[model samples]
Target: MNVRARPFIPAALAVLIGCTAFTSVQADEVQVAVAANFTAPIQAIASDFEKDTGHKLIAAYGATGQFYTQIKNGAPFEVFLAADDTTPERLEKEGDTVPGSRFTYAIGTLALWSAKEGYIDGTDKALLANQYTHLSIANPKAAPYGLAATQVLAKLDLTDKVKNKIVEGQNITQAYQFVSTGNAELGFVALSQIYKNGKVSDGSAWIVPEAMHDPIRQDAVILKKGENNPAAKALADYLKGPKATAIIKSYGYHL
Candidate 1:
């Protein structure tokens, strides 16, 4: 008949089904972009967060600068934990992060470390002495620890001496790896890398004095993408709480 049957399940019904599918896909999970310097402690924290809140955290660790660029281009991270206050402050100013949700979670320590015993002799001058053929440091533009390393070298007037021998890593984690893997005889790395049970690692290390540079105030911020995400906020708050602070401090981060 010209009346033709049941109107063929309505175009509106099909549109509604498609919209449901889209929403389900969008609601999948929360992601966090973390700075490489804080890798170990954050991994532990993320595990505790997932267990306590029943929320999955997909963490991506890289240089803070790279993560900043990604977030600006809509990489879809709900939270950002940076190696320094500078990038988080910039993101907040750009409105990429939730305003007033930024806070310092921990202060990082810089150390010149060597897998070879007594390679550093507990002095910054070792960098200039050419006691080691290769030295690793994070890229100053991408990682805060790299900036600190530069400052320490400059203060010792060893920047020129060691500049040629320097091998730059994209981030602090890789810098640590360079020394550990023997690609570099020594490198500047976060103190947490070698800390276990409130003790330092077997390798020799010279903990850079705090006066050598501006404090490494590692900050965490809630991304604008996560302004309404309960899980993201919960994780942010937990990081500043006593439990997480204790864990961070145990790993040699200054509270």
Candidate 2:
């Protein structure tokens, strides 16, 4: 008697098929509101996160204050990476964020940056010289980094001296752009914006001393809308992990 031949999947092929199916079933997309200052770091982190977790991040970069307003207005954001800890704490208190999901992801540093090489000299000399006609900063009302800039000016007693030359951008990205494009002689921007691999990536910058302004404790939280989104939770956890922390540090943020 002839036996019917059996169709069999090899063990390795079977495991591969199972993993593919598992990833497909578990993969999910999260909508994230990222602070403008964190744009590059988040982009890098998001890429690694997708590859490692098989989850996707759709990020929208803007001022943390604007993100707060949007979230309050019922925007579809599932996670928030804010420029300050206060905003995320407020969101958590207001029930806009998942309980116990908020944490400081990075400590931001302010920088006085100019597109011209060797222009900043890493001190207050250029700012005090009063030669530059235009100085840029983000809108203090809508960005924490902008507020810090104002604070730095106040501490340096240059608020009135530079008031006439101050050019305000809607957000940190625009502030950096103002200087990067030579529309403004210099700008107050996030160190992470111009930093890479532990140094300024381009242009000249003076890393503002932490004592000049309040500690920029950047925080991350899962929003109420993401309460049940595994991808959001996964991302929150990933930010606290080694890979994301390394990326954040490489961009000059303190974890």
Candidate 3:
């Protein structure tokens, strides 16, 4: 006599399995707000973080100051990666971030980049010469990279000469885009924006030395909303780890 085996899964058990899978997928996602200057490295690191930890990162990139305002207004971000230490420190002091979880993740480098090969002529003094009709930089009030650009100009004694020629972008990403699109002859941006895979891009660039300005110490912190989130804490710690540091360094950022 031939016999057939009974179906193993009950209808109720199948529904329970589906619900469990959905909850696991939801739990693995972590929301993050990252400063614009760090966009490249963070995108690279996020992929590695997910591969190694099985946690997904949903990152939003913008000016550090703007993100600070949004977080203050109750944006639901579990982690905040800022372009400078000031904003993260302020958040912690205000109790908006998890106290004691703040740390520097990278040291940012500023660069004056021109999409054309020789537009900047390899020196910043050209700004004083007024050889370029328009220069782009992030808004000093909103972006840390913009603050560094302003310092570079002041140090070169060209602030007066270039002040009126400046065209401001809301964030470093836009500043870079302005130059890339030829809307601005040149622009100040984060080195990471043009540096990748252990080399700088084809654009003309003058890397601003660290001594000329206040250090751009990129800091990362867990928000109060993430105080109890294990995945956010894991990512914050992983960013400080060797693997992540290597990826950051490849993009010309110091850790």
Candidate 4:
């Protein structure tokens, strides 16, 4: 009897098919609303997270307050990285987040930064001197960093002295932009915006004292939308991992 020859599957093609199947079943994507101050660190951490966990993170960076409003309005965010603890706490109370999912991810450090090298003397004295024509700050109503900046100014008793010279950005990224673009001579920004590897990446900066304002206890939480999303919980856990912690610290944020 004549036997028909069977078609053979190539090893490489078989392996490729297996990987595609595994990825389709095991990999997932999460939608994250990240605080503007956390943009850099999150971007860095996301790369490693994706590589290690086979999950993808899609992040939108903006003011924490603005994000809160968006979330309340039914934004499809699976995770929230707020610049302050209160917003997440409020969301939890309002039943918008997964219960017991809130935790502090990083303690932010505020900084007075100027794109021009040596423009700031790294002290409150530079602020008290009132030498700059324009000073940029994020809108305190929307950004926790802005609120911290205002508190620092109030503690220094320079709020009135600098009122006329103040320029507002909608978020911390824009606040930094105001100074980086030379539109403002200096600005109050997140240290992570200008810091790298334990030093300011460019320009001059004075890291604000923790005593100057309430601690910026940045919190992360899984929103109700993410209650059943495995990728969302994976990312939340990844943020607490050593790799992400190192990236956060390298950006000048306190863990």
Stretches off by above 4 angstroms in model 3 are 1-27
Please provide, for model 3 over 1-255, each residue's C-alpha lDDT reduced to its tens digit, 9 standing for 90 to 100. 999998889999999999999768655778999999888888889889988887899999999999999999999999999999999999999989888899999999998888988766666655656788889999899899999999988998889888888999999999998889999988899999998776667778888889989999999999999888778988998998999999889989987
Whole-model Cα lDDT of every candidate shown, in order:
0.87, 0.94, 0.89, 0.94
Give the runs in model 4 whose Cα sits over 4 Å from its true position: 1-19
TM-scores of the models, in the order given: 0.86, 0.92, 0.89, 0.92
Q: What local lDDT does model 4 show for residue 224?
A: 100
Q: Across residues 1-255, which tens digit of lDDT does each residue of candidate 2 receive? A: 999998899999999999999988799999999999999999999899999999999999999999999999999999999999999999998889898999999999999999999998989889878899999999999999999999999998999999999999999999999999999999999999999877899989899999999999999999999999899999999999999999999999987
Weakest 10 consecutive residues, lDDT, candidate 3?
A: 119-128
For model 1, residues 138-177, the per-residue Cα lDDT tens digits are: 9999899999999988988888888889999999989999
RMSD of each predicted structure: 6.0, 4.3, 5.4, 3.8
lDDT: the better of candidates 1 and 3 = 3
lDDT of 1 at 129: 69
What's the number of clashes in each of the models? 0, 0, 0, 0
